[model samples]
Target: MGAVLGLLVVAAGCARQVPPDLVAGAPATTQAGTPAGDIAVQVLRRYLGTPSENSFPERAFPTVYVMDHTFGDAADPSGKQAGGAPIPAATQQRIAEALAPATKVVFVADRETVLEHKESCARVKDDAILITLGPPVGDARRVTVGVNGFVACLGATWLTYVVQYQSGDGWQVTGTTGSMSIA
Candidate 1:
């Protein structure tokens, strides 16, 4: 009987304890998959040249921007916008082709549509032209890429992008949005 009691005590101690805030039927918390910010930066770098190079061309209009989206404030482009550079036409094409395999890109022409979608969609929003990327079915992840023209200073714009995946009950931002600025 002593041995049985000892075993029972050990088993009881080993049992998992739920935190006070967690309800009995609550779904188990899950960590996100691979970070989307790192992937986005890597992809951009693969297409565009390194920082040392004169990546932003002087005459490129509506320049291309890529940011980490995990650091700075999405509202103020100047605050969090980190790397701003222009992407050459060829490089832009390459980026599209490369990202085509995993992401479905949607381009929003005007600011109103972008704002509308950002407001309506069950996701966070920033002040930028929205580019929504839908993952293939069963992926359970979505990426929103945005570019705000003339955000920080004259002739400057910023890119704010976010990666989110479904959590236990709802979707959550995996990491903060990454941003880039170009002038």
Candidate 2:
């Protein structure tokens, strides 16, 4: 476990991105077994370095990290909706499998189960990470997902990244479309 800090759940933009130099190694190259799984792992890795994934990068979260399987009440980054819906069981399994290599202790379960567990943790408001994945569209070379690091009722952020295949580059995060944060 690490220190508990503020929350930051990000809702990303369409495709506007930061320079490649800033994001460095954002390529989807992992043993997650599938493209979506690979992308999810990579995106989570970006946040795991922090306590609430964005705001508390310096604080250490002092327990096993819990991820809600379904998007639950998380806002949709697609702009076509508000909260996200449940992901297929297969998709959940794939992403969960890929999460094993993330180093930090983590587990994926239903919202109810995760919420129940969260209630029993030392820090209730600043733990759980809710996740949502946008399926592969077009040529299946591009994918996006949302990560919500809940640190408190108000402290949080939402940032969405645009990941695309660059022919010889494989699946890489070309840019971030948008981001919102609160502390």
Candidate 3:
């Protein structure tokens, strides 16, 4: 009987070990000093999806988009200026306010990326936004999130986002806007 009890204890200890698959598949968590891009991508993935029928029956879009921008040039790095309507000043101001009380800020922008792997959606020039926030002082216990996007079936969409970390509370969405045309 004692031998059997010892064996059971050993088996339980082994079972407590984390599985290799779970460790590999686990999503990265936000830390106090996580990079801006990492935080942005994490936030974006969390909210990427079509809205429910009751929310917006006329417009439903995909969750992921084709990322074609070069590294480090996410926010109009060319300096020549691309052809598309810029994000409105009022909207931009709101985004800025959402990311208040931060030590640093990063900006990213891209154009001509396809949305939801759909060829027709690609032509629409959909713009997506993602924001990530960190704690005020010590390591962040959680992340604050704010995302917005506009998908125009007939026209172009503009995307922009900001990341900030200072020290505060759990993650929350401050603002968001999205639309897509079916016809």
| Superposition TM-score, candidate 3 onto the true structure | 0.28
List residue ranges in candidate 2 displaced over 4 A: 1-34, 50-53, 60-85, 101-139, 167-169
57-169, model 1: which lDDT tens digit per residue? 33222223222112122224444333222222333344345455443222222324333233334221332223211111112244333333332223343443343454552
Global lDDT of each model? 0.29, 0.41, 0.27
Clashing pairs in 1: 67-179, 68-178, 69-176, 69-177, 69-178, 69-179, 70-177, 84-181
lDDT of 3 by residue, 133-161 (tens): 11111124322222223344433222222
Supply the global lDDT for candidate 1: 0.29
Query: Least accurate stretch of 10 residues (summed lDDT) in model 2?
Result: 1-10
Winner by lDDT: 2
| Tens-digit lDDT string for candidate 2 (94-128) | 54565554344444443334343443442232354
Order by TM-score, highest first? 2, 3, 1
- Model 3 CA deviation exceeding 4 Å by range: 1-32, 42-60, 68-155, 166-183
